[model samples]
Target: MVLHDLRKYSFWGLLSLAINLMYTKIIFPCALLVRRPAHIRILGSYSIGRGFTSGPGLILDVLNDNAELLIGSNVKLNHRCHIGVMKSVKIGNDVLFASNVFISDHTHGSYIGDMQSNPLQPPNEREIVCGNVEIGDKVWIGENVAVLLGVSIGESSIIGANSVVTKDIPAFSIAVGSPARVIKTWDKAVEKWVAVS
Candidate 1:
């Protein structure tokens, strides 16, 4: 399974390496209007669906493979954000993404099939297998952050901007740092979520 996925993402990542951002100005607005979403605003050249558009610097790559990158209503992806979906990535309602955020369901590179020219060979592929990336309701993903594969961020969690989440985060927690540890817990009564001591 891992080998299969490794080949899947690596192949597509190279295949769909489009750097041109010119299509957004013309192709995006019409796609959204045709789809008729509540809101849409695209600034960069992202291969997007009809329902994607909000804020500037939002860059989407390889949109055709993302049959699973589902965005909820009132959710906004800010500028310079990258969303990569290989398997399934579901976002709940009212979520916000600051600048330079990245979310994906699968690893970017994997080797799942035989690299040699053979019709039938053992799949010599190493892959980072993950279930999915599910963002719960009212979540806030900060800038320059990477949400890795098989990572489930709980509902109402505030991921510190520019952090990398490689594991599952529980609900109502504030996670930060490279591996994104639970730095603090959200205290509804304190009028502010306190960091985990």
Candidate 2:
């Protein structure tokens, strides 16, 4: 009875290991929206590096052939994170994104006129305004953050929760608020982060 139990345990362990390997190697590479190792949905194109991990409900949408979404190694994207790339979006290595973060490099229609006037025309049919978004290495983006078009986030920066990033964030800085102001920056001389006076 002891020997039979040992064999059963070993067989189950091997089966689990095989499933994990298949999910990581075969399924993840082919799937567009990956909910888990086994569950995935087709959506967009991704140029991802090694050791990329994402939680449930990640949306990656590449609009056209010119659109490119490049994610570097060891990046972790938490639940319900949406990344829409109409032009280009380059994310560097070791980046951590919390839940409900939205990053988009394009906007629907030109900022010329109000859309309420034309009720018949669908918004999706309008022209898209696109730009490139570049995020450097070791950046941590908190929950409910929205990163807009043409923004460049420098290395080792921290984006606070519920912030809207409309402009560039400098390296080693902590930014917060609606426009995402730089509230603090890492002072290399002091070996710590200092508040902006």
Candidate that scores best on lDDT: 2
Each prediction's whole-model lDDT (CA): 0.65, 0.82
Q: Provide the global lDDT of candidate 1 against the true structure.
A: 0.65
Q: Write the per-residue lDDT of candidate 1 for residues 126-178, one digit (tens) a residue.
A: 33343578999889998789998889999999899779999999999999989
How high is each candidate's TM-score?
0.61, 0.79
Q: State how far residue 84 of model 2 sits from its true place (Å).
A: 0.6
Candidate 2 residue lDDT tens string, 78-107: 898888888889999999999999999988
With a 3 Å backbone cut-off (N, CA, C), the pairs that clash in candidate 2 are none
Please list the residue runs of candidate 2 whose C-alpha ends up more than 4 Å from where it truly belongs after superposition. 1-21, 29-34, 37-45, 112-121
**In TM-score terms, which candidate is top?**
2
User: Cα deviation in Å at residue 142, candidate 2?
Assistant: 0.3
